[model samples]
Target: MKKIIFSLLVLAASFSANAQVDRSTMPKAGPAPEINLSKPQSFELKNGLKVIVVENHKLPRVAYTLTLDNPPIQEGDKTGAATLSGALLGKGSTSISKDAYNEEVDFMGARINFGSQYAAASGLTQYSDRILELLADAAINPNFTEEEFNKEKALLIDNLKTNEKSVSAAASTASRALLYGKDHPKGEFETPAGLENVTLADAKAFYNKAFIPNNAYLVVVGDVDFKNIKKIVTSNFKDWKKGSALPAAFTTPKNVVSTEIDFIDMPNAVQSEVIVENLVSLKMSDPDYFPVLMANQILGGGGEGRLFLNLREDKGYTYGAYSSIGNDKYGMTSFSASASVRNMVTDSSVVAFLEEIDRIRETPVSEKDLKNAKAKYVGSFVRSLEQPATVARFALNIETENLPEDFYQNYLSKINAVTIADVQRVAKKYFLSDNSRIVIAGKGSEVLSNLENVSFKGKTIPVKFYDKEGNAVEKPKYEVALPEGVTKQTVLNNYLEAIGGKDKVAALESLLMVGEGSVQGTPLKLTMKKTNKEQFVQMIEVMGNVMSKQVLNGDTAVITAQGQTVTPTPEQLKDLKAESAIVAELNMLDDETIKLEKIEKVDGKNAYVLALNEKKKAFYDTESGLKIKEETTQEMQGQTFVQTVLFGDYKEVKGVQFPTKLSQSMGPQNIEFTFSEVKVNEGVTEADFK
Candidate 1:
């Protein structure tokens, strides 16, 4: 009896211990610390090197950041020159080739990066004590080899070319130009010609003028011993002479008094790109910054924010939408939101965005909204401590912005202090729906026609198309012609088999394939995933790296890439539907006579041509026949390339025929293959497309 009683007692104790809740019936955390912050310790070396040290011995590693405040490179002509110069600096240093430098850095587990901004040239490094010397080498001994410079320059040009094709980039680029005059530093655009002029001499000159230790500040944080770090820096950078201090100059233009409707034409865009931007005044240290930040959070910050709740959850007009205030050095802030809506609803969506903006400015936020926003901001701020790098970055921002060291410590209190009156005042003052610069980049013909003939402050504004150089751009010619004799059915079958096998492909409700290849002598990879309703591609090497396209009800098409989500242009959407219908028709083909036409030179290469037609004469219809086109091309990478495939083949799998092979030329040398190991339709779920 005693043994049984003791076992019951032990089990109860175990359950009680396991069921303990950390927060249940516990006292709430007290208000944050309100302690005064100590000023940063600083000293200047004889050669003009400025050192700012913040000692925090909590972690056993150090982070070093060097910044050279330089003037914006020659105003309007070559905006990206400084950026290109910074990139070229780290390609090769005095004692190392580009490849050798990359290998050494990889082996040492060290990282180095340089970039040019409006006011500074910055380089950052973080590593243990053992790799500090290598970091110094990278900073002080940049060789700027001609070979590497040329290679990097070409790559930059290619990147710019790729950006031009992106809708989001085009919208942002156009918006900046409209908000700030094209000549302003904040609004300047980088052109291909500007990149073309960045010679090795130009990079060397920029480096010589800006990379002076006397005109630079070195901030060292973490487990760094000041004495040891100073010694290492002196040894690596002592001989560097001081250069002339560049003048500090920047101008933020007054907001335009009238609404401007700028349009960028993408002929076959599946969705419209929209951005409504207007200048706002909220400096980093201003009393209104805290309140405004909280207000924007409530207005349209994230999934739970106002914009998302209205546009996505309630109306289903878009997948997602949000707004933000980008606080910069010059106190420039703009609230913007984007969404991809059907062509018919394009105008209605714009009306909704504007209506929400106006509503916020006119009415005070509810107590519930204010509380949720504050809680989210405070909670997220506390959670950010889980990442060391993020903590360091926040610390750096605090220092750079000249905010109090304990600024973040009292973050919640400051946000909580903001009242509904404060929210209304900032919104009224900053949110200018009347004069906002509304820019749309998409199939202008279809979208513009549907929009209520909008006038900027009552003046009619005409839509215009401009190239990257801000000059009028012509419409692109899209010519896709299939070789004669190939029937649509045969082409469809070949394409299906090439991907995998029809049975397996059809069974798969969704599929994802990743491929690696070479471009301009560099290895690159891309990942693509597809389902009946949507497709997504991550081209690992590009800006706006996440791109997605989707189909709805087998008729409408939508695409989200870069920062913009758009539905296809009217014509493009029409084409998309036609393509879908063709695919369906191809799926029905059983047996067809396919013939390989004679080899023909295409794009400077001999390509094998194939044709397909219905086998039975009774089923043949010249008007209804669909053509199939296939070509083979050689791909190269570095010193190696393959005279591989760009061919389409059909094979049977699970009693269905499908295309299984897809090959494309990557550059001068490499060919990429996208192979599927298994594709089975076991049962596709609706959530898979989402």
Candidate 2:
């Protein structure tokens, strides 16, 4: 009881002391804290390898890093030379077999990877000496032969094939090409031809010319003695050839004269990839570096960024969106904000994206925003300091970037001193609203019209179209007139003849197709059945779990998905009925609205376009008469999405031709369905339709 009474008395005294102070006045922050950063021990070998060692005994692990400060070079036809050189590295040495080398590394539980301009190894300090020796042996005496080159070349070719259809991949390559001209190193891409042009001799020559130690820096950090590391590094790198790599000269990147929209048409893209970027001359040594970084953090750093809050939280147009500002020493730097959004909102998203940038440039951020950005930087810097590798990296950066030795020492104070005015100043300087390129790769038919009229602050946005190779192309013609001697029946009859004889296609009564494939990386099995009487059923299973089912048994049509059932709209019902027939193209013959629209190029092939209905356009290969593409619009959840269906791999099944491979795109997702089982006439029945 006495202790409780004493506590109450102390609480009353504290309240009295607090009440005596002013409540409205803000409390002043304490003086900046002192920083005691560790400095790395540095030494240079006669071979020109500069080694930096930082010792910390807190952990039993050590990391050794070798950075080649080679300037970015345009590879021309040999774009994969550096990449091949890196792949050839660590394959094996004269004294060590590849198998034995891998086994020994695994035995010691060490991780090492070699890149074009960098290599690193991290493992327990107990094996530090062996790891260093192994790294040195592989770095100097690499074994490159035809066997590994062939294997690596095949893998690279496969990657290029896969990238051909990926929307994000196309956007990345195209963005670089659009921002920096194709002649620049940043714009070069590795193609199959380029990779094939690389020989083993070429790889070796690249390694010899670029891996010289003159501009190389090795950082050693962790539970190792500085003196021992210096000796080990000298012993390992002493025999390395004493040569200097000549720096590469690159064509400087230039910004646009005015803000413009650059578009690349990707037929299979479900979502549009948008990148609003500008070229700048930023470096770590510039006074605007910290402020620009802080301003970018406020604009689109992460989940808490303004881009996310506005584009995702407010409009729900995308999953995530972000922006970044980067700096480089040898070449021009860039600032960009990128996001992939549903096609319907591509224009709106672009507008909102520009609006955020404009807001930052024209409007100064609030006091709270400035404080939060500073806190974020300060926190990230402090957390990074906990890692020994960060210390080694800081040392290397100071040398390579020509920064003051004490730049990192006052990191916190510099961040805290940044006022709201600094953030606005850098934002305006770097985020060039009037001279930026809005580079986008998407379905041109769906988003192009909307972009042509997009305006920001009452100024109409200018649009430019470019091919995947960054070549300027004429605007795609939207409304082409039907040519003479081409009628609706001419295209239809040609398609029938290309697939099968007209008599054979007309003889088809019932069809059943069992296709197995993937949608967005998920396994999907599609079972579709149709009869001559318009009795149709379609079901989809994702990994054997039925995801959706649609049925039309000559009467009511209903669909089930996500544990809910609903009757499709009248338009959907009409579409289903048109497709319910065993041969969907036959319905076009009977419908009065169907007409020959025009002839256009679909995937570089001359295709005759037919308006099947108010919302569907079918493209048929003019030469082969096979249906090549289907363009349709869908209304889902109060939003309209344009979908494109591609057909290929036609095969004969019981005297009828059917597409064995199918792909469909719907708002940023690709769905590929390949038929494993197909039947005609006898396999489908009323029971199957139910």
Clash totals in order = 33, 3
Judged by TM-score, which candidate is best?
A: 2
Cα lDDT for residue 97, model 2?
A: 90
lDDT (CA) for every model shown?
Answer: 0.59, 0.85
Candidate 2 lDDT over 1-690, as tens digits, reads 999999999999999998999879888877666666777888899888998888888999999999988787677888898888888788878789989999999999998778767788999999999999888888877878789877887888887986687778878888888888888889998888778888888888888888878879999998999888888888888888956567667787799998999998875666899999999889999888888888999999988789999998888878779999888988787899999888889999999999999999889899888888877878888899898878988989998999998888877787788778898899889998888999898878678999999998799999999877778899876554566788898888788878887788789888889998886577899999988887888999988888999998776798999778999999779778887878777656666789887776666667888888778889998788899899887767655566889999999998899998988877667778899888988788677765
- For model 1, residues 1-690, the per-residue Cα lDDT tens digits are 999999999999999997885756757647754533323566667788766665566656556667764444344565665666677666656776778877866776656666542111112234444355555565667767777678878888887875664556777787777676676666787777777766777777767766777657766665666787777767766766887877656566677676555666654343566777788766676778898888789878888888889877777666667888866644465667666554445566776777788788888889889989988987887676654444445555675566776776677788878999999998887777777766777645456675536443355544555543444555422233445766645545554554455665555455444455545555545544445443322234333244334443345456565567787788656445433431343334653454543433332233334433321111121221222222222222211111223423444444544335444432113344444432333333444334
- Model 2 local distance difference test score: 0.85
Position 289, candidate 2: lDDT: 84
